[model samples]
Target chain A: MKRSERLVDMTKYLMERPHTLISLPFFAQRYGAAKSSISEDLAILKHTLAGNQDGILETVAGAAGGVRYIPYLGKEHAENYLEDLAVRVQDPKRILPGNFVYLSDILGNPQDLRQIGKLIATRYAYAKVDTVMTIETKGIALAQAVARYLNVPFVTARKRSKVTEGATVSVNYISSSLDRVSKMELPTRALPKGSNVLIVDDFMKGGGTLTGMQELVHEFEGSITGICVLCEADFDKEKLVSDYLSLIKIDQINQQEKVISSKPGNFLTETDFSRF
Target chain B: MKRSERLVDMTKYLMERPHTLISLPFFAQRYGAAKSSISEDLAILKHTLAGNQDGILETVAGAAGGVRYIPYLGKEHAENYLEDLAVRVQDPKRILPGNFVYLSDILGNPQDLRQIGKLIATRYAYAKVDTVMTIETKGIALAQAVARYLNVPFVTARKRSKVTEGATVSVNYISSSLDRVSKMELPTRALPKGSNVLIVDDFMKGGGTLTGMQELVHEFEGSITGICVLCEADFDKEKLVSDYLSLIKIDQINQQEKVISSKPGNFLTETDFSRF
Candidate 1:
């Protein structure tokens, strides 16, 4: 293949499989090009991605050296996205009953999911995240998006057990929003012991569900590398978990007044975008 | 930017926003190049994607002209993937109690989701699929995967409604597996009226859940563009719905003998790969 053709295919291939190592010989054989030629093609790809600040191509030097694509966003890009997302969240029409903000539309949008996923994946890019864990329903999309970029499996915890999943390990935690105990379970085989897990959710109200997931990870003898939520109810009464990051923080949602206010969460300050 | 850098960024940009058009002038402006140069870069990308049979770059002519990337797979690639997937499904260890196969691992896998998403998107690439819908829990990941490829929003039909979602429209269907009438719902604001929806799910026994989703779509005054499932139990009782495609068909699952048998479904034969 010609250099131009090889560059197009290489960019698509690496973007599809982020955080995966692809040896020079593999590319050389795929394109039927010399090793030196392949190296030059990769240099172009790496440079272009770095210039765009949306992706990264890492060159590992050694006997097993290869190029790995990392789904990352520059600090400026992250800030702009969060700012726009926060503004969108400020729509008063999104206010739901009991001070809950309706965010299912944003959660369901592919473009929004892509940006959110990349942002979360960028934060945990260097962390030892063997598996991405989330509770059932809304959190599944966020978890899958992050896992796709991280090149890892994501497991969902269900509030109710299903026979299809076989054996499961259950955990109970306070449902702070409702002020009641709720149980969640993960399939016994879904996650392996001693794995490093990154917990994610769509919303955090007092961090009850987050705590439940944390305990479930412990049940499998796994360590919690990080906790992240798409939105956090900052005005909610005391949180159950503190070591967590949120992309958007909802400071107020006045159902009676039909008003909502939010801003970019601590994720902006907590994340180090200097990895490149 | 040089031609090489333009090609790299153009490929990445088009791949990120599948099914969305990018005008020549847009690329020309982004890369600080001439319109003719942008067209040449897109041509290289289109040819490479076609040769590989993994993606399609549709070029529009005259005024309002641009290029659109379509996530597609060749017949051979789809066949090989399904065959390999069927063989993997035959593992006796995957058989759970009550003859249910454990497929959470596959659903949780990023690589598997990408292949599955692309395959399903390839089938509906030409259809007017305005939205992708799936029942909650296991299907969210699959729904999001397909939605990402199709550049459409996906809405989940919940077994139970939540206050955060606002109003909902509920439907009742016979749960053939449980042999009981079950209810499912979708938030009123989740899907708009008169949408072209493509329904997807992780598994299908008698396809009760799919039927429920079909009804929910109808309630929204929308049309069903297509229905696709990742796996179907061929040995199960008569299906509730007939117009659907499955990637894998499980012919048998003997819990006592710990034996399972499966094969690729009608997807290969049903899909037309000559669109290119």
Candidate 2:
């Protein structure tokens, strides 16, 4: 293939499999081009990605090393995405009957999920996460998104038992929203013991659900690498867990006044983005 | 930017926003290049995508015209993926005591989900789907995968009610394994009326759960665009619904005898890949 054609295919191939090592010989064989040409094509890709500040292509020095693509967004890109996301979360029309914010729109949005996932993945790009964990229903999307970027499998904990799962390990935590004890469970074989796990959820109300996930992680003998939530309800009385990060914090939800206030949470400051 | 750089950015931009239309002039202005240059860049991208048969750079003419990136996979890609998937699923260790297949690995694997999602998305790329729907538990992963590629929000129907979702629409489904009627529900606002929804599941034993999803779609006055499953148990009883696609089919599984057989299902044959 010509250099231009090889560059097009090489860019697409690397982007699809981020953080994966690819050898020049493999690309040469795939493109039927010389290793020198393949190397040159990669240099162009690396320069293009670096110039855009949207991605990174790292070159490895040895026979086993060639190039690795990292799906990254520069500081400006991250800030712009969070600011727009916070604004969208602040829409008053999202307020539901019992003061619940209707965030299904954001949760379902592909672009939003992509940024959120990449942001979280960027935070843990070096964490060496074995698995991503989240509770059922709402947290599934956030968990799956982060897991995708990290190239790891995400395990979901369910509140109820299903025969389909075969066997499960259950954990109980205080449900502050309902003022009762709630139980969540994970399939027995979902996570290998002693593996590193990153916990994620859509909303953190008093952090009760997060604690449940923590307990479940402990049961599996896996240590919690980190915990993050898309939204945190600051107006709620008392939190069940700390040392967690939120992308957006909802400080006030005054249904009577039809008001809501939010901003990008501590995720930015909490994240160690100095890896690159 | 030169055509080389423009081609790289255009590929990334179009791939990131699948199924969305982008005008040629928009790119022309973004690159500070002439319309003719932008057109050449798009042609390169379209040709690259077409040659691989991995995606389609759809061009629409007239006043509302530009290009759309459609996620697609070739027959060989689908066959190779599903064949390997079937072999993995046939592992005796994956066979649970109650004839259940341990699919947690597949559900958690990002690589597998990406391929599966892209393949299913290709089938319905032109179907104008408004949403993707699935039942709780394993089906969540499949639904999210397809939804991610389709660039649509996926709604999960819970087997039981949770306090988070406030109000819901419930439907009755025959629990084939339990041989009893069971109920499933989705949030009242999860699906808007008149949506064209594609239903997906992790496994289909008797297609009972899919029927329930169809019923919920009916209650909302929405239409079922299509139905698909990751695995279908051909050895099981006749299905409750027809017109569904399965990525893999388990023809036999006798735990006591320690035997299993499977292959890719009818999806490859039934899907219309004429667009590429």
Candidate 3:
């Protein structure tokens, strides 16, 4: 193939398999091009991605060395997207009963998920995340999006057990929203033992749900690499977990006044973007 | 930017926003190049995608003209993936009590989701799908995958009502597995009226869950563009719905013998890949 054609295919291939190492010889064989020429094509891809500031193509130097595409959005891109997302979150129409902000629209949106996923994946890009875990219903989208970019499998925890999942390990946590204890469980075989898990959810009210996931990870004999939520209710009474990151923070939701206020969460500051 | 850089960025840009059009002038301005140069870049990208048969770069002509990256996998790719998937499905270890097959591993896999999403997207690439819908829990991953490729929003139908989702429109369907009448619903504001929706799910036994989603779509005054499931049990007594596509067919599940059999479904024969 020609250099132009090789560059286009290479970009698509790498983008699809983020955080995956591709050997130079593999590319060379795929394109039927010389190793030196393959190197030149990769250089163009790496330089193009770096110039756009939306992706990174890291080159590993050794016998096993190859290019790995890291879905790292630049700091500026992160700030702009989060700010816009926060503004969208401030819409008064999103206010639900009992101070719950409706985020189904954002969670269901592909464009939003892409950015949110990339942003979260960028934060944990360097972390040893063997699996992405989320509680089912809403958090599945966010978890899948992040998993797509990180090139890792994502498992969903369910509030109720189903016949399809065989056996499960359950965990109980305080349901702050309902003021009761709620149980969530994961399939026993869904996650491997001693795996590093990144917990994610759509919303956090007092961080109860997050703790449930943390405990479930422990039940599987796995470690929690990090925890992140798409939205956090900042005004909610004392949180159950503190070492977590959120993309958007909902500071206020006035029921009677029909008003809402939000801002970008700690994900902007807590994430280390210096590697790019 | 040079032609090489433009091709790389253009490929990534179009791949990210599938089914969306980008005018020549937009690319021209973004790359600081002439319209003719941008046209040439798109041609190279188009030819490359066409050659691979895994994607389609559709070009529109005249005043409102641009390119659309359609995530269409070729017939061979579809056949190969589904065959390998069927083999994996035949694993006796995947059999659960009540003759249910364990697919949590495949559903959680990013690679499998990517292939499944592209295959379904390929089938519905030319359809007018306003949104993708699925029943909650397992189907969310499949819905999200297809929605990402189609660049549309996906809404989940819940088995039980939740406070997070505002008001919901509920429907009753026969749960063949439990042999009981079950209810499922979607939030009132989740899907807009008069949408052309594509329904997807992870598994189908007697097609009960799919029909429930179909009814929910109708309740929202939306039209069903297409219905698809990742796996369908052929041994089931009868199906509730007839007009649907499945990627894999589970022929038998012998609980006593601990044996399972599967094969590719109707997707390969039903889809039209002649456009390429």
- lDDT for each candidate structure: 0.92, 0.85, 0.92
After TM-score superposition, the amount by which residue B272's alpha carbon in candidate 2 deviates from its true location, in angstroms, is: 2.3
lDDT tens string, model 2, B1-276? 876777777888887889989998899898899987877777777788889989988888877899888998877787788888888888877776667788888988889889999999999988879999988778888888888888888988888766556678899999786679999998888899989999999988888888899999999999999999999989989899999999899998798987778888989889887776
Using DockQ as the measure, the top candidate is 1
What tens digits encode model 1's per-residue C-alpha lDDT throughout B1-276? Answer: 999999998888888899998888998899899998888888889999999999999999978989899999999899999999999999999998877788889999999999999999999999999999998888888999999999999999888767667888999998888899999998888899999999999889998888899998899999999999999999979999999999999999989988899999998899999977
Tens digit per residue, CA lDDT, model 3, A126-162:
9999999999878999999999999999999998867
| lDDT, residue A214, candidate 3 | 94
- Score residue B244 of candidate 1 by CA lDDT: 96
Give the DockQ ranking, best first: 1, 3, 2
lDDT per residue for candidate 2 within A171-230, as digits (tens), equals 999877777999999888888999899999998888888899999999999999999999
lDDT of 3 at A200: 97
Docking class of 1: high
In candidate 2, how many Å is residue B146 off?
A: 0.9
lDDT of 3 by residue, B67-89 (tens): 88899998889999999999999
* Candidates' RMSD to native: 0.9, 1.8, 0.9
